[model samples]
Target: MTTIDPGAELKARIAEIKERFAIESAGGKLTVRRDDGLYRHLEVEMPKSSAYWFEVMTWPGALAITGHTGSHIFRRDEDMLLFFRTCMGPGPDWKIDTRYWAEKVQPDGIGSTGVQSYAEDRVKAYIKQAAQEAEADHPGLLAEVEEELFSRYSKADLETEAGAKAALAAFEFDGFRFDTAGWEFTEYDYWFLYTCQALAWTVAQYDARVQVAA
Candidate 1:
């Protein structure tokens, strides 16, 4: 079998996502939605300034105008699971930073990095447990899911040094930062914008598959 470069695959996927979903401002708000009956409709919303920053930020001054207000609605268990698996990870410790929502939901609540990490870790644990139960109940379904994931993102390539470096560079160029605690998603960051695109692409693929199966 021909080995695929994980970094190359990831770069290609990101490019494809960017092309597939052209982020446009919907007045003062930007919303991307995909409704597939087999999966929950994926709905993501952010401020127009935030979208502009992601799509057309040329200088640091542009950052001053963007707000980090955003919302993600995953209405079904399968949609959430797919998100965790594809965007976050299928690994036991993988997590999605919820700091933006956390701050909005409880501004006076514990707002330290440690607190956010702990909260995300707890959520990861629950996702992992649920995934395990799902795998047990579905027999070969887990393998199928893994296969599908691999087709899109090859693990072997990502493990290679070059691939790892490329992935890091891509994230950093998009303004992601890592500290002792973990990766941080800055306000109006490129990573979040890319994630919105990725989720939309994934939902479209799922919708296509559902149509074919039906």
Candidate 2:
């Protein structure tokens, strides 16, 4: 049997991410260390001027960012990228908070994510959770659902009451039915799906500015 190596995949992805961002061109530094050929740790230091400095570090499942203002730990790459993106720019809004995901660097009660978008992300997370929980209560239910949907995902949507009802409506087999009326969405940071391209433009802009100043 051939074994697929997740660490190898992650190494390639991380390398691709760095190349896509072109961090060095912006006078930023991104360094990585490997263990037994598996990409393991990462550290990032954005170009520092009198007004700004930021850093990012990651290991295994955890990622952290720090700025002059504050720092935070993040589990989701989307959250990390979006927050970091928030701090790169030309003015008050661009200042790094602590880690420089330094996003909007808003005080409590302020957020960079849009209201509807935040709600949607919450709904999606809630649904995925509900599906997993329901499956735990009814083993093999998810396998059946996956078979029906022809998707390889481990779970299904079931966050809102309406969505839960829709899930019930979608599949009914003998004694199989999804019960998710009581599932509740947990609110948290609103983050976007991350891509290196999402951050490349800002890096390019920063690099150009530094070059002109030089």
Candidate 3:
């Protein structure tokens, strides 16, 4: 079996997206149009950290051009390209910091003190489902995933309660108002694992698209 280099594959995918969609950027905004002439405008906001957040609005009407909007945050340029590709396809419904984590950590009817417990329960549930799927479908890819994880995060960094709190602090973003101090150490580790899973799934989706086009 051939080992997949995610960095190289991501670069190629980004290039293909630029060529196929005629993506253009100017004055902090990236723009692209669909084959049907619907246009998407992405406004990016760069924070002090390397991660950038974006809000995208799409317009379908020729005269009025009214459509919905969505937002996402990406830690790298390659992630932004994958975001664009997913937008062109089914339109991404996932909002990492704002929607997903917020809902998990602060579900409806939950008070402040319940946040950690709620998040822990949800993470535990997700891990069980994720492990089953990973074992069944992609056992061969686990080592590569682990290597990528270690490159981004130290084992020591994820093993302790203090490290878990620090990881949450480092990854905190605007519009995601939460108290990381309340989060359990296991929750932090699960968050990192979940992020890696999401990234791998996105790359797989992009690869599938490429194969279908070919």
Candidate 4:
């Protein structure tokens, strides 16, 4: 399908959110609310009949959401969107940084490590090429080699350089080569398969948390 660009996509989503919601900010607090939207069409906190809205909060190491609607946790077709960034830890602009998660893959910052997140198309093409070259060098080489390794030695034996070299000798037969290192993994990128899961969990936390608070 389509490739992912997490940072760009996040920004776009934030912009669209701005268009649909009214945002209020002061010091360590922020609020996002909507005017014309009703609460029935949305998945909200099920308030006991009152106004409804939605919110998203962010800081150095925290993110949260809160809202209400027409009545009884008024659900709405479109949600109120409020985004907050405090002047607490880091500077005001884009406070979330390397510490927000891991380096390299997550934030697209490559320093000493040679880490990179690959697009699906490139990954697929690379796999196809590597497979073609590998099969050409020796048919069923990878599978046969694995079976031979297990049949020849125990896990301890394979731990040694000599044992590993011997077991994987097929890889060096005539001229077989492949990039053994795959692309890097990160939570920040939309390409990350877990993006949806993570977002759902964030909202779930808000749901559980507000329920307890109320």
Candidate 5:
């Protein structure tokens, strides 16, 4: 596989999206290496369709996630929530300062809380609606299927090498589509994540999201 420059990819994507989607406020930002990681930050405008996919895949629990192009603020205590921040930006212009915190709900629920709690009713409703549509459209449910298969194992087991092997053995999203509600568990979550990265890489090859100053 060839290497990619995330900054260029982000800008090109934004312009391309603006042209094709025809949404004025709909835009994106890219940030590279703010928190020290190999992957580039991508904060897309989160179109209705993509937002549905993001929620189904990430599955944030008991916290609120609010975001826009330059900012994506997620409130969750789970360890993965921290990683969510990095995932917010596309390449080099995303921010995580206090100004982005528009509201906080339900007080911190646990120790040294890392995420914000907002009402889940809206997102839940959207997710439910989206699931019905996906079922009809047959868009492929990799994340849900994978998470369910892996959920059976204890947290400790998931951390061990044996657990990883056992997990992958359970299911592979590419081969099938899982028809389930609420994502009980699956072995395909990690596989789905990596596969998504690979998909993004593939897209970048054909359509580099390059930034062009206005």
Candidate 6:
């Protein structure tokens, strides 16, 4: 029997997500880029269904209306778990609360693949609990959460093939940073723009030997 590599499979999964958003007919498709820190990011540019482009994108932070400018950021860092932990309080209005997941599943026997355990009943239980709690806090939050979580993420609709390639080429090489406590959407956008500007700072980190090898 042939052995399958889990790491390779994870990468493939990321690629699959990118492929899903590669359509061109509305604005553009999604793009994914790999970084040195084992971070791979997927960015999708949404289209306007309104006469006024700016008005089309206006939405309260984390609310589910049709077509909003947002990106689902995921990282392998254990620290990202804090966001999930915080969700158990007021709850993450927009996304799944993974901290409750750890609480329900108990991290001990989580399995080497990490993917397998995701299908377990405990994961579903955490999702249900989080959903119930969120719904209790604000009933609409559940519908919004479900829409973002389970809705068909059929790729952005671009006008032409060239436009699709342009969108892919536009993926900024920077990752994002945000403090849920302090930053609003505008602040988040500001930092995201600046982070794109600072992406090249990574190039300077290489030692002369490493630079030469590259």
> RMSDs, each prediction?
21.5, 15.3, 19.4, 15.1, 18.2, 22.9
Per-residue lDDT tens digits for candidate 3, residues 59-169, read 432111111112112322233444434443443332233223323222233334121222333332332333344544555433433342234554425444455445434
- Give me the runs in candidate 6 sitting further than 4 Å from their true place: 24-214
Error of 2 at 120 (Å): 14
Candidate 1 per-residue C-alpha lDDT over 39-119 given as tens digits, one digit per residue, 9 for 90 to 100: 233333434343432211112111101123232222223334343345444433333433332222212234332212122
Q: Total clashing residue pairs per candidate?
A: 0, 10, 0, 13, 36, 6
Residue-level lDDT tens digits of model 4 in 1-214: 1244445655664445433332211111212232222221213321323343234333333333334311111111133111111211333223222222223122213332212233333333443455555775678755543444444553423444344434334334335544435422222333121222222333344434455769
Q: Which candidate gets the maximum TM-score versus the true structure?
A: 2
Off by over 4 Å in 2: 1-147, 151-168, 179-214
Model 5 over residues 77-188: C-alpha lDDT tens digits?
Answer: 4433344344444643333222223222233445322322221232223334444455445445534632453345423233433453354355334344323234222221
Candidate 1 wrongly placed segments (more than 4 Å): 1-17, 20-187
The true-versus-predicted C-alpha distance at residue 88 of model 6, in Å, is: 32
Ranking by lDDT: 2, 1, 3, 4, 5, 6
Once model 4 is optimally superposed onto the true structure by TM-score, how far is the C-alpha of residue 132 displaced, in angstroms? Answer: 5.5
lDDT of each: 0.34, 0.42, 0.34, 0.33, 0.33, 0.29
TM-score of 2: 0.26
TM-score (C-alpha, index-matched) for candidate 3: 0.19
In angstroms, give how far residue 89 of model 3 lies from its true place. Answer: 25
- lDDT (10s digit) by residue, model 2, range 1-214: 1133333533554456445434533665544432222123344455645434444454544444454423545453443333344545454233323222323222334643321122334344443454566776677766666565336552444434455446546766446565545433332222211222223334344345446769
Instruction: Give the alpha carbon lDDT tens digit for every residue of 41-115 in model 6.
Output: 323333433321110111112111112322122233243323233443332122322233322321224332121
lDDT-best of 1 and 4: 1
